[model samples]
Target: MTKKAYSKLLATATTTAIVASAFAPAASADSKDFSDVSTRYADAVSFLADKGAEGFPDGTFGTHLSIKRVDAAVLIAKVLELDTENAPASGFKDVPARAVGAVNALKEAEIAYGKNSSTFDPDSHVTRGEIALWIERAFQLEGSVEVPFEDVNNRYKDAISMMVANDITQGLTETEFGVSALAKRGDFAIFLHKAYQAMVEQSDFLLTVMHTNDTHGNIQDIAKRATAIEHVRSENPEALLLDAGDVFSGTLYFNEFLGQADLEFMNYLGYDAMTFGNHEFDLGASADGHKALADFIKGAEFPFVSANVDFTKDSTFDGLQNFEVSEDPADGEIYNGIVKEVDGEKVGIFGLTTEETPFISSTGEVQFQDYIERATEMVDKFENQGINKIIALTHLGYDDSLQYDNDLELAKQVDGIDVIVGGHSHTTLDEPVLNEDGEEPTVLVQTGEYGKALGTLDVTFDENGVLTGYAGELIKVSDLEADPVVADMLKPYTEQIEAIKTQSIGKEAAVVLDGVRENVRTKETNLGNLITDGMLAKAKTINPDTVIALQNGGGIRESIDKGDITMGEILTVMPFGNSLGIMELTGAEIIEALEHSVSAAPTASGAFLQVSGLNFTYDSSKPAGERVQTVKVQDGSDLVDIDENASYFVATNTFTAKGGDNYDVFKKAYEDGRLSEPGYVDFEMFAEYLKGLEKIEPTVENRIVDLNAAE
Candidate 1:
């Protein structure tokens, strides 16, 4: 028989006279009646009755009937009308061979799966928790309901929350739940009936605030993200979208197009809010970074907020609201946080970024304050103004122990902050982390970085602005259906990226693999050697005396994977938009910088250099500057020892020229205005230079052998 015909046959047999008799016992007396069932559930029996689900022959509704695994599968298949054409093969030895097809069908529908080892215990009694999970899987329900269960920890945590969120099951007693216990037939019926009603009356008034962080100019997956958001929003009408920042920098897209296209795309998607990320200042804190921010803000219909950033001194972000307070029509007053009525309940959202932004952000002109201090002040201000339901949208990292305090710390320290919507550090919180404060649980959530996932928190608040409860999940974008509108928005960029993908660079006779793991930091790789050689070669055109070029290993983002390397791939490998800079430094200063690089060997920092036209020996056991005992320069015929007092021409990137890589010695060299011929060394230009050489091969030889290796 064809698959559809087979499914129809199974459904007919399962609901036929014999099967109907078996199920009739469940609706008979001696069946349990669920006392806690909501009033809406009265209509549930009628709905089912209209569909010909009658009470058993005993005149007793067997509402407390123990559901078997096979029966559970059948119910789910019947409810979803799932096609079983490509179902997973049932490998359960205990399941009756005749019942295997039903189990496979349920698995194909994604409504059921074995706990482990592919064993679907077909005869095992289904528990209340299992039923709850199956109901949730069959229908995607997003709302917060009261589950007054106590003892429902870990194993059934998600299931219980889902049951509550969908109004399927309440606790056994007033405040207790035996999640693992088998549910009575009447109670199960009531639960399923309530869930069925919820599915029918699923509110369109629900507003989902889906968010992501640390995009870092990765526009390639924009359509994928847009599709996922659209799928979520289509399920709920009042969906408000937001981004957690770090949307610019990191990739060639930002370097080539700046933030204009990214901002325009975010605007097109109707993003509700965006907080500032440290990398937003990659272009510098002056007019460059602020100008981008101004352009993005001007084009965006929504607000961009940061309560901790004191932009009073900055001219560019003068009019933007740092802290906005407004009255929520559904609830009461709200401050700093945005007030939106979702499912007829008002929610308040505020935002904060890491205080370390000043140090890590390329914007040297802007300053950041203590995050907790600023956040607490904002909370107090909002609370005093009678706004109680608060959500702090934080960009701080998730870890919040006393030693590594961050957003979770902010959640714990501050009072009246209900939830902390967070980003940065790219943490994927599967479930909301509950703060240990004891007074009220603070829900902390963060979606993993790169637009790979969306964080959702479905919450419910009492009329008094107190969080009665909530349910949350990190929806993986890969699992969602793509939004066509978002796909169209990103089509132009996708076309450009696709056009560049296959374009050939100069052919390599031999492989020049990125020996990043082994030599990029502690020493030099042939790849790094080639790059620095090119930088020095380009630098020498202006100053022939330049003997050495130093490139920080961190600037080289990707390795040259084996194959016919293309120009686009090379560009991706070195996407940072840094330029070459030549400077004159005393031999002592060069030695000082080398020592700094060697000292970092213990910590394994990327600031360690891959050098060309020079070699150095260091004793890491010695402290900092004293580590480098010897330095040499090749002078055509011989390797000459460096004289500390002799001035030498050096080449490095502009990031290092400004005393980056902990090279304070260069700061003085910069102060003396000895820096010359500072021009942009597009990494692509270096790649092109490599292409011209054809058959280029580079390897990792021990350029910086540890003298202390034996020890």
Candidate 2:
């Protein structure tokens, strides 16, 4: 028979068996006429009589009597409505022809086995432990819960545990599982009854998770997000709302109010949990190191999960964090992990910040541990506590080039994580990505950056906590109506931000400055030239030896219209709060860094460089590491070829100087104390440079030339 047809039959028979055991024996029923049956066994005897079950032909259910293996097989086969007439041969010499088909059918279904290679042992009484294993296998029961029965051996522990978890049986006593005791007919009836009921009620468990990441303090559409969340919760009230961090930087909201404005709306919307993104620690280098972060945490309405981040060394977070998973999590506290019960199922959630945070952001004394090791520990802890459903709320980028970390690597290396809510790369996944290389599948999802969209994932799991099916999508927040309360609360913040948007910086662009993502990341643009020139000029002021400047194309966020530039436009272009740094590197090291800049040429890479005070040419046809043709540095009045062993001072953003975007050469210099950060924020420097410019005219001057491009 087909599996689907058989499953349908089993479900039907399971419900029938449980129904037969629930009701007391009816006085007028002809099936209740068995003389040897007591009230406890009467219902089962009546059910057997109506179904014409085997071993009850003498009008006696034989209450307290042990059932033979063959008779037990016949009863189960009849209840499951298996085709006994067409069953295959048992291949046993001692089996009776009348019961051979029933025993063979049970064997074919993998619910029963022979005592020896050739012996059916049809006459042997079935043991309670044996029955438990058979029932568990027949129905495909799963899960384990602590049980009081101590007599169950290791061999039968899994089956017994599954039975107890399903409420199918409780054993003979509080301390004894009766593994070796004979299965009495009266007791088997109740066991079968509960198993039947459990089977009848079994269906795939459905869970809905709504998530956001890299919001970057863009709360302009938070009201719409609230409406979207309400709509999703209207369908599934138990749906969890999660954030993957980076809500502390970018945009005017962060600069003015720190993270408190975002936190207010987050609390109002009822965020279940949050994890730290690299940008959340942006203020760690300030005089009030991590004080803003601490206040953000203290004002939050939900608990925070951070398995790999250690805030113990930073007194700003003292007494606010616990180092273990919390079963009863409190608001405004941090934990290594948290257990949340949704619709009677326990879901374990833990957080992982990028290990690169120390170099990329101002983490100060807040140490970060290895992601893989900490993730494994969290998984083990949750599993030990009987939690099978797990989620890793992470700021590790999705499919990031960092092999040591990333959502893809985490899913492949970790064993039990079922879902990953990811951020940090600003990836927009239209549908959830699945990594099935491990023992079980993991669903990785992220919404695009800047609060433009809300992501939703609807997943289904079997009784074993195995992901069976899923459907996910990104909902455009702009399409949704703003929630009235959230809209009202946003008025004060928007008014303040509006005032900041209109104030001019007393400079007009002579022409449209090209900072388009496609233009800036692929090749040099006028805006890139202007920005790098500004960096070079500012660095020279700090250290006269700073002769070369480089800016990552990713930092140029928006374009400038050919008109009076406002503070808002400049902040929009360079919103990451990255500061300036001067790095002392050998000429050979400068050449090596330039080679990496064009490695993904023809394809846009965020690591691509826009330079000033120096010019370079590369052949894109050559292999990535061998692409550079020549590099020259400004030497007084002339451009000269760089000497491999000579040292040169190069100006770049602190992010690049500290090895952001996989710049190993620059990172080495930063680590060796060859880098000095004067701490001038990028936008502030750009504003100053624009004011000093004669006429705001900027042009591409072939500073970065790719040889393979057609003339």
For this target, which candidate reaches the highest lDDT against the unseen true structure?
2
Q: Give the poorly placed runs of model 2, Cα more than 4 Å off.
A: 1-201, 504-527, 533-565, 571-711
Q: What are the per-residue Cα lDDT tens digits for candidate 1 across 585-623?
A: 888888888887888665666788888777877777777
Query: What lDDT tens digits, residue by residue, belong to model 2 across residues 1-711?
Result: 133353444345324432121112332233366667677766665556444543344655566788777777776776665666677876777766666777788888888889865888988899999998888877775578877787888889888998999877778888998989999877776666566557656756667899999887789999999999999898779999999988977667888899899999999988999999988998888989899999999999999999999999989999999999998999999999999999899999999998867765788899999999999999999999999899999998785544336888899999999999999766789988878878788989999777889999876666788876666789999999999999999999999989988888898998999999988998989999999999999888767888999999999999999999999899889977676778889999999999999999978988999999888999888899999998888898789998889999899987888788899999898656576644456887898799998899899888899989944
Full-model lDDT, candidate 2: 0.83
Clashes of each: 18, 0
Error of 1 at 135 (Å): 21
Backbone steric clashes in candidate 1, count: 18
Q: How high is the CA lDDT of each candidate model?
A: 0.64, 0.83
Once fitted onto the true fold, the runs of candidate 1 whose alpha carbons sit more than 4 angstroms away are: 1-43, 46-208, 285-289, 327-336, 400-405, 498-524, 528-567, 571-711
Q: What's the distance in Å from true for residue 165, model 1?
A: 24
Candidate that would win on TM-score: 2
How far residue 533's Cα lies from its native spot in candidate 1, in Å, is 12
